[model samples]
Target: MQIKPKFGVDQLLFGMKQTDVKSIYGNPNKQFKDEDQNVIYVYNQQKMRLTFYEDEDFRLGYIIASDPELTLFNNTILGRKATEVQKELEQHSFKTWEKEDFDLAENHFNEDHWLILQSEYDQIVKVEIGAIIKNQDEFDWKFGAK
Candidate 1:
């Protein structure tokens, strides 16, 4: 299925209600609330996970997709060679950063969103798209001022 690129997956983006997500992707395989009260929806068959912050009107805040069928705006497919994906992203003028094991590409259309490609050797094993929560101090405590 060709997924239309958006802030999130397809029409699912920041400020979209949970019901909207369900309407498009159907009910998640599993759902739960974290200790922080954020709702988590896992679609194992689709190889995707969506997270919504409880404080943010229960809107979609994060999306992780490892499905090979999913493709970015530039038609970059998940699980492709990292170099190939990098080239596709570069061709679209998206700024990229090379990490130790993976690479990160910032969405040129939306600064708050990012694409995380987990790589092994020279191949991308996973892909994640998510919004950057502004109040890192309150929401993301894992990485503190680093």
Candidate 2:
């Protein structure tokens, strides 16, 4: 059996934070009232939603992704609450983050992790590895997957 090398979705959700959502997608596109009249931040797209809202305390609210791809990501991560994702992110070594989302190519990945930014023209990916670095290495970090 050949096990594909892909990052675990559970890991992605484990250490995520509300700030991570904001940093990734900026602000939500729409705001509206739920049945409770709480301010709902709706970053909605075709059949997709990355919503946020505040509780009575006014602290950072939950950031949720309501898309089918989220379900296919990893069963362990399915239906994960915002707080759950934040916890997972905390466990992994801190790596640089990207705002965009989409497919990543092999060149984008290092030995350990890669952050891919979804863009209109091209996808930007940032790679991070677990190793000691005495100095910077020169590699053409930007290239298409194809």
lDDT of each: 0.64, 0.32
TM-score of each: 0.71, 0.28
lDDT of candidate 1 over 31-106, digit per residue (tens)? 9999999999998877888888898667776777777777776475765776666666665665655455314432
lDDT of 1: 0.64
Model 2 stretches astray by more than 4 angstroms: 1-20, 46-55, 60-64, 76-146
What lDDT is reached at residue 51 by model 2?
Answer: 24
Q: Residues 1-146, candidate 2: write the lDDT tens digits.
A: 11011321212221234355457556667756677544554556512232222333222222233333443223232234323332454455524343433444222222334322122223221111211222364222111112
Report backbone clashes per prediction.
0, 14
For every candidate in turn, the CA RMSD to the true structure comes to 7.5, 17.1
